[model samples]
Target: MMSSPSPTTAQASSTAVAKRIARTARLALEKKFAVVTAQIDRELESAEDVVIDCFYNADSRTSQLNKDDEYVHLLKLRSRQPFSLVKSIVLKDGEYEGHVALIMKQAFPFAFMKLNMEIRKHVYEYLFESEEKVIRIKTKTGGQKLPYAPGYNTYNRAAILAVSSEVRLEALPVMYDRKFCFESTSILMHFLLQICDGRIYLTDLNVESYVGSTARTSFYLLANCKRLRRIFFKHISSNEQPKTAIKNFWNDAQPWLTAASAGQGDPTAALKLLVFDRTAFHFRVKDPNSKSTSVKAWQLADHLVFVKGLKDKLMDARKV
Candidate 1:
């Protein structure tokens, strides 16, 4: 007869089974996360009207009561991969009484689409397992009580999607390869312009922050955004010569800018104004859809005259 298995053998078998069970459970949670996120994306695409009404319309039913809340802000997904970014928002009561919840309309099943903290942890583990610093949990402090799940009192968290955490502008992790993907610039711009208070006074000039070593990158990125109204670029350090680099960058990108402007019917139309200084750069656009009065042909000529002439003037002054 076969000898009965030893206790050590039985223990080993049990350990292996436990590991498999844990692995399977983890995978199941990840799959659920994938399905929910995919469904959210599909709903977003089909429900453009709902998105606008719920998020943008301040006079909408949801905003009617919260109008007095001064700290109203939109939450946005910040990701190096363009498609992975989810467009979502979080609104809080200025007095800090209620839960910080995701902004959603009644039409969408916010409860079903929302993710539990456990699932968010799993998703981040799957996608950014190597980069743990990117995702963070907000600690309760200053009399702010965050929402929590059952059986928890101190640290409460609900199925709310929170993507509006503040991130250092230029010091993104190395995983985000900006030059390889131009949309990265768009994502960063949206973070600075749309998600934030709609403007950034850039004091950091790291190449990664600008997405490239030239001003052309900023121009191309801004060309795609319609909501950004104004931005100020100032030199934080003397080592970084922004004015000279920007002039060269603009000249290289002018052909593409001209073509884009012509398509829009006004050369200065895509952007309202671009003011250059040896120490700073200022930009303004009245409205995304608004067009400039100057004709396309004349706008290009005028820009060349202004930009090139300004560059020459600065250079000549330095010689004296």
Candidate 2:
């Protein structure tokens, strides 16, 4: 038989074992916390890089930001955090201050309306209108569509219009004044749909036409544009049943001409010009009565001449 251990010895052994277990748990917790902190720091750094890139290379940076996992995670984390906690962490005096300031400016824009009217107009023109820049509506690789200024190498200035309703009301006319060039009638219609009522201010448009329901519908929508002044149609096909095509063209244009005549009280509101590709003049249509007879498409121009109110509003694209 062995002697029983003392109570004091047994108590001391139990305390020692408890301390080892406690120490291991503490170390594991500390390691996990350190890893989490490091990951947060990395995400912050990545977010900072994205913000900076947005100002310098907007188009590419925007695309990258949309796909970045770490940035997305940071956004979700920030959304979950309490406002006080977020402010204390993000607004601490350090490398993040500048980025925070930029974000704040965007979030809370200055009172642009307080500026003088002329200054506001100038700023709007500078951002939205340029003689050298023709805003081109384009589709991206992911099938997302938006307008861009290829000549200026920048995205469309429409972002400013979303600042506030006041800004949009003041800036819309200036924005719609820019000449928009689209690849096809369908793209033009899509843009018109996106802009909604902004079409009322549109003055200049350039587009390639396709003979189909989409083109007819696009023209029908355009007829409602009360201030449209000029439209340049490119690559119209002359061989597509000239008589029927000419009839459809006149029908599509009739609404616009009627509107222009009705708005004669406002001289500036009338359609000033309609330009078409020279190819449209070569249309050959078979006479319905004579099976073998083909007629020249000059009838299209002739029909325009006979319209009651249109005086020298039509021209070949080359003349423009």
Candidate with maximal TM-score? 2
Clashing pairs in 2: none
lDDT of 2 by residue, 161-276 (tens): 88789989999988898788888777887778777879899988898766555676677677678777788878666564445555556565655654554536543234446677
Model 1, range 1-320, lDDT digits (tens) per residue?
89988999999999999999999999999998666554432112224443332123233224233467654533233223223223345445565446454443333323422666566445433432223232221223356333211222233221122433322222122112111111223334333343232222222112222334444544544444333333323221222233554455455445434433444444444233332323332233344466643211223434455456544543443345
- What TM-score would candidate 2 get against the native? 0.53
Worst 10-residue stretch by lDDT in candidate 2?
51-60
Residue 205's lDDT within candidate 1 is 18
Candidate 2 to native Cα RMSD, angstroms: 19.9
Listed in order, each prediction's TM-score against the native is 0.23, 0.53
Q: Backbone collision count in every prediction?
A: 5, 0
